[model samples]
Target: MVSSTAQPPATKRLAGRTALVTGGSRGIGRAIAERLGREGARVGVHFGGDATAAKDTATAIEAAGGTAFTVQARLGKAGDAEGLWSAFDAQADGLDILVNNAGVNGGQVRPAEVTPEAFDHLFAVNTKAPFFITQQGLSRLRDGGRIINVSSGLTRGGAAPDLLAYAMTKGAIDVFTMTLAKELGARAITVNAVAPGVVDTDMNADWLRASAEAQAGVSAASPLGRVGVPDDIAGVAAFLASEDSRWVTGQWIDATGGALF
Candidate 1:
């Protein structure tokens, strides 16, 4: 039994805000962009070379009663971050949330087998891009804004030797989170990292959905007894973007489905 006057709860937590999600065309980035859009933030869907995917994400956001636009830049190239921001500036006046979600796995290669070329490229996109992106974004990022860096679960341990280089990048992200949190405390901005494990996105479809045994093994790896989805991590990113996380910063939130702990 319910009263006719009972109203629905509000879903718009970020009304009048603007967000930029790098690599927002697919997977966790897409999910985060959509989630932020749902919260009422006008999202800038940044994609490297996927115009269709980027447009689809923006269209989906608009269809859901939110606002969004697309920005493009091939990360790891010269002036990539600057190019992204330039395009972003033409669309939005300022930013309220910056989700540094673009990254690469650098393939599965051991330290001994890793090449200098691969290593440089990996750091360029995974580490260097975000660092300078944030640096350049400071002027546009409003006070009390949020900066969320997407990280990986491999940073917690060195068990995955094949991902040694990739894991190192996440470690740098974690450190960036802490250092930036401290530096931006005066302005009340919150900086944090969300590390996910074995998420069932297209990036992992090759192995994750390859066989029942493979899927079952991944599911069993997490104490929650399931593989993670993009939305699983998106929910966390939304929280960090919202005012509800005002007091939280410099934290490496494990959105890993209890895989490490």
Candidate 2:
């Protein structure tokens, strides 16, 4: 009954799958959306503002023989999650993956100087929005699905006194990912967090922007000897999105350049 050379069928991993990525207009989120498309998943690109950026992301996917649509919403707001999912609903029936990537620095440069208002804002986006969005996603995500939350290594290491508020938000994300993984495991859905090290994105380009010295300083400290690129994080996210990680959950994978706290 077993045929050695018999091909069972043509299996397309994500050929008919659908994924929604928040803050996909640019930076790490953009790269994630694009990578999912390359893997044959129809992408729902979520952007806060900058319609042009979202459009460009979608267009690039379409041009590269992939499927994608744009969904815009502010990640830190209450009603935005629903609206974002509503847009994704138009393109597909059920969601296969949800990538929570939208986050802010909380405007706190130092821990002692952080205000309650600024700190709260960081939780809203970095933690709260992702929590609520993941809740809503349960209704849309298939029984067997994937959820990836973005976090930062700052949460594990010592606080940047100034970046304290932002770091706290990431800590909340760590807990969220762990707890949700247990809750959703029975449903066959996996949840995990990807914590990144210092990335040379426009989000952090100010001090390190085009400055070789700044880059060198950061690079010299990390074991990898280089700052992060979008693709570096994207690769891990792509793995989490695929069946390759079907048995993995409730764990935080650090994409940091071997930078220890």
Candidate 3:
């Protein structure tokens, strides 16, 4: 007999939809792709140079009874968006959700230590790629599609001075989210940004994984009393991709565990 508290088998909320998540080979991108796949969307897990991790993410999605395929394209270069969409078109007809989750942290370059080349590359991958990717993808993205841009809490200020350039890119992304939402509203599509704080990922391994004291310090920065995980951000993306967020757009949803406050 079914227990009163036991829920029914999960329902596929995104059945028959198609989603493409860049940098989906690991970390938050991986979690987002897997979550979307579990909700029944055929996921395109895009990776750069990491075929093994991409395959692993796809395998995990399939193992969980979802359909997924890997797409490879190195962002931050010329024609990167075209290459990505060409690969995407080979597998799916159109897009229902586009998660621009790929980016670089620009290392630890302060204002005095920053180089022009480094700054250019940071914008190329973090800002320029997503801008054009979405531009070209507008035709393939069906009316009412969801476009989720992964921003950062650093844009809100109060972060390290060395992250200045990185924060600037995210600031641009926030502006992109607002303007695109207005432009795409006519088609019922939603454009929004999710700004996550210091998440526990390979990107921050030098500090977060260094020692217990460092871990405690990072965790204490958040009111939640713990480091943010990839899944913590993925849960927010899933909500934005669903019908429930149809009424939400042109906004930056801070997933910073109250660090911004």
Tens digits of per-residue lDDT for model 3, 177-199: 99999999999999999999988
How many clashes show up in model 2?
Answer: 5
Model 1 bad stretches (over 4 Å): 1-10
Q: Which residue segments of model 2 deviate by more than 4 Å? A: 1-12
Rank ordering of all candidates by lDDT, starting from the highest: 1, 3, 2
Q: What is candidate 1's lDDT per residue for 1-261, written digit by digit as tens?
A: 111222123389999999999999999999899989988999999999989999999999998888999999999999998999999999899999999999988767888999999999999999999999999999999999999999988888444888898888889999999999999999999999999988887877776778788778877877778778888888899999999999999999988888886
Candidate 1 colliding pairs:
none
Tell me the tens digit of each residue's lDDT in model 2 across 134-192. 88889999988999999998877667788877888889899999999999999999999
What TM-score does candidate 3 get on C-alpha atoms? 0.95
lDDT of 1 at 242: 96
Error of 2 at 113 (Å): 2.1
Please list the C-alpha lDDT of all candidates, in the order they appear. 0.91, 0.84, 0.90
Which structure is stronger by lDDT: 2 or 3?
A: 3
Worst 10 residues of 1 by lDDT: 1-10
RMSD of each: 4.9, 7.2, 4.4
- Kindly state the number of residue pairs that clash in model 1: 0
